[model samples]
Target chain A: MTVAAEKQPAVDRDVCIEVSNVTLRFGGVTSLADAGLSLRRGEVLAVIGPNGAGKTSLFNCLTGVYRPQEGNVLYRSRGGREVSLLDRKPHQICRLGVARTFQNIRLFAALTAFENVKIGAEIRQRTGPIGAMLGMPWVRRAERVSDEHAHDLLAFVGVQHRSNIIASALAYGEQRRLEIARALATDPEVLLLDEPAAGTNPAEKRDLESLINRINKELGVTVLLIEHDMRLVMSVAMNVVVLNFGRVIASGTPAEVQGDPAVVEAYLGTPADGGDGDAAPR
Target chain B: MTTLSAVARRARWWNHARVRRIGAYVFAGIVVALVTGPGGSEGHYSNGLRHGLLAPRVIPFIVGGLVVWAAVELGGRQLYRVRPLVTTVVSGSQRRWQSPVVRLVSYGLLLVVAIVYPMHISEFWRVVAANEIAIYVLLAIGLNVVIGFAGLLDLGYIAFFAIGAYATAYFTGRLPIHAPFTLNPFLVIPLAIGLALISGVILGFPTLRLRGDYLAIVTLGFGEIVYEFAKNQQGITTGSAGVFNIPHFSIHLLDINYDWGLPSLPYYYVSLGFIVVVMFLFSRLENSRVGRAWTAIREDEVAAAATGVATLKYKLMAFAIGASTSGLAGVLFASKVGSITPDAFTLQYSILVLVLVIFGGMGSIAGVALGAAVLTWLPELLRTHVNPQNRFIYFGMLIIIMMIFRPQGLLPSRRRAREIRFAEAGLEGADALGPTPGSGLTS
Candidate 1:
């Protein structure tokens, strides 16, 4: 058995999301091919790959933004009902408890921080049109509760002080944090973080790690992170999935994947003279 | 503990709510007494209110006006509550049943007052109030769809108004009919509407991709085009001479000949009915999935599409729906005026409608209605009591004042209110930019 499989024995059988034989073609280019990964509940799985490894495309397919010509993305809902993620709409996937943050923040800039978060909760809001229009008791109550919840979520991401600020006014780091909070407001079963630390400073990166850890441990939310920062991913993720040329080259513990010869070849393009630095940790 | 502070905070808001409720009751009581009590006398307030209710043309206006105010307030509150500038404290949990009930009761009261108003008012005052209100209501509703729901800034919507009026004239005027083209005046309404829809589609198709200021400019161009068309199309629209002595609409049967002659009170009722129907449909559409789609697109088109909302299709839908409403209003307007002229439709009318929607509350049915009534009546009231020569100045000043003091309008929807409040708060450092430094350059 693989080291990753051995380390996660209890959750090894608890695979809630499985991406198998997924191949994506963009005209003449192949974005992803035969890439397979399993995400279990209450686990943080990091997808680390080179620049052109099609990490974002994989995310898009998993979130139903794209349909791969040949692949099956099976997602097991909270109720243990298996469903195809590729068959659903993005909003439907969101409604089905799969929320994702974008690599480039996608916030409603004109809206206040509170409103930005509330929009994530809009799909789950129980009030009907008449209720919203008339400001009926039920709608009003729901809105108030949602507003408070949004505030709490913002606080969770350390942006509570900026609650009334317009989203566009926020700094880059704050905006990224706000996006995460907004995604969390949807109350997703699994949170997908796309390059959460891309433009963040070192201090902000540490905070992000703690935030993600807390969310996974305390909130009991599963996490699927796609990050380019190798050190951060190696430090936090329980299992690591590495991709090269849209295909999975290695899947195991961080240490095991780190030492793989294929991963070295994928990163350095087949090495220099006889693989002298093949096992180097750099 | 932290729980104690939370409870205390809740208690404070509860106290504020109590104070607000008491204040509302006191204010309502005082106003009611002032209007209905003996000391009020038969002066401006009494006359205005009575005239507003009694005139056949005015009754619809009164009902529509009140509805507009309520809608604006609701919309403004929602929109403003989210703004940083407005530290809004949400009070007692909203009671779902009370809102609809309150709206229904308010409308019913307005209708009742309208029906009984003429019994105690002067006929001339009544006629003036009624006529102004109905026309403005139609204009406001049409503009609301474009500016409010679609988030399109149209500086020349009045062109559609002109098109409908001219179409009516060409069909029903003394122009020579090549064949057996005699049709009922009521039928002309549908034809006018159809023509307006086609015009809207023609205009909207190319302009849908334009954003904000650019779109406004294009629409302004279209409005000018319509006006110019009416002025130059002498062979069809009688040019600047304009179509005159156009016959009032009538339905003739075997026994009853229902001729709605000149003063056009019956026509007011027809306009009222049409406004109500449109208002109902607008409200429904605003709350539907389509309405949500429009708002989503308005907020962020790229994000909306990422979420599976078809942006182009919905934007076009907004243009089509908004224009269609205006077309319906146009037909009513043409029928009521009983004439067609290029002078009737102008950029001024478009600006007036835009002002009404903005002053009332964008994307709010009731707010638009209120805006329509106020702007409509204000000019006429000025013409009668105030200086007629400086009426334009007064309106321009009013628009400026509304923008500065109550940008969300008298009865802004909650959402609009929140936006205005947010903008006012200078949340995004927008205020720091300080009064649009290059404003003159853009103008």
Candidate 2:
């Protein structure tokens, strides 16, 4: 892993998203205070912190759920256009090649697993409502393509066997993988996972780790995740950022951040009360 | 310590056989009194205690109450003993109906019945009664798209109906305000649809941002506003008197003239044709990308948005499409009546259509059609035989009983049935239900 990192020229690696001094507040309480980070193309980056750290808030701001009061979130489109992501809607961000999953699984509970993945491809569907209402051949062909693509994504995420099952009926680990498959169906250039390994056993976590690695390496999609699982963050992420309260405490390679004193203090200060079970000192 | 000793004494008293036996007799006596209370059947005929204990009504009620109480006590004991077996059998039967073939055959048989219905009926009933049922079915299906599929609880769906009716009035030169030229009612159908579509967008664009009950309140206000506008705009709508003598739906082509005149036959066929077309289009929309997007938004708007489903756009689309169906029905209504009135497009009409949708399964096309037909026909059937005051009471009781037993619907859409079952099973969120069949992209 270190050898590949050393071989890649720093100047050649493109930055996909740049968060510059972004500040977000909910009334008097500040959730993110002048926080900034950059996600490089085709790399796995993890944002790790204790409870109440602005990790999930940073993800929300990037996805346009909450607008930052100051600074900008800028994205480099595949066509090499610099697009400002501020004032844009969440779906607009998704259309511009950003996809995200919720911290708590938010699958379409009444829809089948196959249908859940198909909804992700809706952003890229060219057929309009009129064409669909008319049941035109072109619309049918597009639907067929979407169906096949959804199945492929399900298989890619290793949940194809549960395709016919309702999303809510799936095992917890399967729901997590299905959510990832649904996100992938959007053809996103950058994927954000909010606590993707949460509530999973050791075996499921190992499966998730390899899946994230495959998504990053084989598919060449950029990933930015908010995770409390240190094993996942240390093993999978090439870059890690540590947050405490509402600010970034340290940012570097996973090994470098792990060795930082601020990171240690954030995690080890009150393991019994403040730290999440997974993030506590082991 | 005194409170504890008091509780112990109460427990000992409750355990005594004579006290238990006396308690049962008192319970039976209270039930007897309740049975002959003021709200009872024969209470209306009697003043107070003037009727003797041996009076015909008094004796029957007293005896019947005791018998019912004893049966209930005996049955409760037996049912409690076999409740586990009963619960398993009920769940097992519910699972059996989940099979797709049973649903498919039932739907097919229903379709065949609907197609042959107008043919077997009398001319008067077919032209007047059946035509009305067909028109209401169209409205119910339209509202179902918004409330059922899109999960937008629209309470002002009748506003679209009013717009459609008024559009026909204006285009046919029936309104007092202004008319560029009179157009054939058939030709003006598209204009009426367009007007309703614009109104839907106007209502949806601003209010779609609000969710659940807030949206419902706004739509309710919107319906009232439309009604008031039609009732008060004397210069245009003629106020309560309404526009009159709207031309019959007709056509003159290739030296042949066809008029949907007073026989009501042509109007019946016309409404049926529209119903068939709308149902086909709706089912197609339900099984497509648009339908999936609507379902996603309904379940979780934030997740749907994050997944690239444009939430507002789909909501508005559902609103407009739902409005279009009501517009068509309104046009048919106008042509049939040869007049349009503000009274016809009341809030009651909106609520009636909503009831039909809920009575039938919301998301199921066949279910709404059945609901509309049954609701429309049942009232008409009761009108001649039953007392007018009692008819509404009976209808209310029936609806309450329906909701208690089958909250999902008579013929539930697969997803809705599972959702209701999950809720019944003490699940916290609707999202906890297992996999439902028939959520594919194809119909």
Candidate 3:
């Protein structure tokens, strides 16, 4: 399997994560079947599908939230290190520079906004439990850095005013932004955002489009998004991958996938019409 | 017409929710008094009721009603409306007491009082303070790390305590199976802690994955297993006879030599010292990075893991810390008593210690310590009034009432207070992480 994939010459070291022939099934139901995609370095790739095309499941497979029974997820870090994410726990994958946010907002609701971000930032720091307990000078220094970074990220996401407020008390848009800030705090080289603009207003959606661009361009991080907003995807994503019934039916530039007959038919009524993908945002 | 209107207005007062709650409290107080009250002269409630019309009973009821009403009303956020002067004085004193210099002076005075307290107390009281109150305080503080900090329920914690005591006995050559070399009780502290830590890791590695009630039931079974093993294993644990003649702790360093003998005062001092040390360490750990990690895990495990917090490792760490503390307390117990028995390490002690943690305030250091002291000593104080075996009946009543009235415990941590207060106000409750698999209303 490795020789065949290597012989193709497409699985290069620059691919941040490669999902090939990865299949996930729940009992008798198949959430994903032989689905595959590659996230290249420092690129914005959007995964689009109807309600049950297994977009989130593919994200889960990449982020180590779920294991694929059929194939493996290969993660290659920025410094030329290779790791198979199949056997790793969520935290271990996170430590390996893979960070993600949930489709449903999953911040620590009881913690302060600053605390939520700081918890994320501190995960990558090298401090053992004993060091934390002893409050060694280096640990304090590392903690101070994390605190400052949390403050910075909060401001970066434009929610610094809600620093001390508990996360549950924040507004809907603010919570979404705070979750982004938290995901960014992991210092991730690759970020997986699951439906970040799901319930936001038009103005908040505009803010989210720019935020994704900044996260991809300013931070030099590879972005893999599962978004339903076709306007945001066409405007921000470099390429789009469309899934239908747990299969990647279309993969190309935004304009190309937008005109694919399979994409239009899978989204609209039938394969006979040439309806633009922008009309199927729901 | 004016008199009739006034009568109607007066009748409407009981409809208020707060008033109805106070009425419920009064009824509960009355029921407790009636059921737990002393037997009548003829061993019948009617016999006692026929004469006085409950004169003293009526008086006690009125007093109790007034107290509950005051507690309910004053416990509200708007205390100034009732008495501005009282509220001002309370807030002013709290602010003053929390200032750095004032807190330092208060702590110094407190330490002095603690030191001077047992020295002058009666021998019987001193023994009770050390044997019953102080020991349980140590155990409660240990369990606080598990239940309070980690939000994991452990009903089999006493198993670790038993392990510690057995390690102490084995090290001192008191058990039927002797050690390779007899060691002083002081020397056995570290070994016992290591043993308890390893035991906790063994138990928690597989079972910690089970959340809330399931984890609690597993810990409960672990405790029963240890208890049965101690009871039935004659060759190893001396088979219900228990290990006897465990030596007292002593230190012989350089020219200075001190021995913990049969006097209970030294034991109280030592226990107090350990309690102080553990409190300091745990409090320091509360706001640190590790502490935040624990809070994150407790709040939402899946989110915590996604954010790179190792949930399993930190959870296992909490179990180990809690178990090691229980072990240390066990070593102290064996040394202080100079005898060990399976009777001392029962499921009842685990429940009683949990009660202390909840009664005091789950995560607050001073609160749990105060809870342990009060609950344990109160029963002893009532030794002449009530049979010792019936003490749990009162505790059950106290816990049930407390759960209804003040589920956050007596003095909650600031974060917990905020969460519970928000939850009570119908905010930050079911809607936040309501359907998440890692977080639920486990309690």
Identify the candidate with maximal DockQ. 2
Question: Once superposed on the true structure, which residue ranges of model 1 sit more than 4 Å away at CA?
Answer: A1-100, A103-193, A196-282, B1-98, B118-131, B173-180, B253-256, B427-443
| Candidate 1 lDDT over residue span B1-443, tens digit each | 89999788778954665444544544444444333322212245355345434435444444454554455555657766566444333332234324888778787787677556645656554555445577778878877877776677877788777766666666665443221475556777777777877888788878776767778889999999888977887876677787775666788889879887766456666677777777877787675545665665565554554444455566776766666667667666666666666787888888878878888878788888988888877877777654466466668878987888877787776555655565677542122112211122111
As for lDDT, the candidate ahead, 1 or 3, is 3
Candidate 2 lDDT score at position B300: 71
DockQ for every model comes to 0.08, 0.53, 0.49
Each candidate's root-mean-square deviation in Å?
14.6, 6.2, 5.0
Candidates' chain A TM-scores: 0.95, 0.91, 0.92
Candidate 2 whole-model C-alpha lDDT, 0 to 1: 0.82
Per-residue lDDT tens digits for candidate 2, residues B289-391, read: 9999988877777788889988899999999999988887888888787887799888898998998998988788878888888888777776665554446
**Tens-digit per-residue lDDT, B1-443, candidate 3:** 99999778768978666777776777766665565555344345474344333546645765686687777686665554668888889889888977989977877887798889888889999989888888899999899888877778899999999999999999999888979998999999999999999999999999887776788889999999999999889999997898888898898999979999899998899889988888878877877887888777777778888999988899999999999999999999998888888988789989889989988887777778888888888887766665555566666777798879988788777566666776777753222112235354111
Query: What shift in Å separates residue A63 of candidate 2 from its native position after superposition?
Result: 0.6
TM of each candidate vs. truth: 0.60, 0.85, 0.89
Point out the worst 10-residue segment of candidate 2 chain B by lDDT.
B434-443
lDDT against the true structure, per candidate, is 0.72, 0.82, 0.84
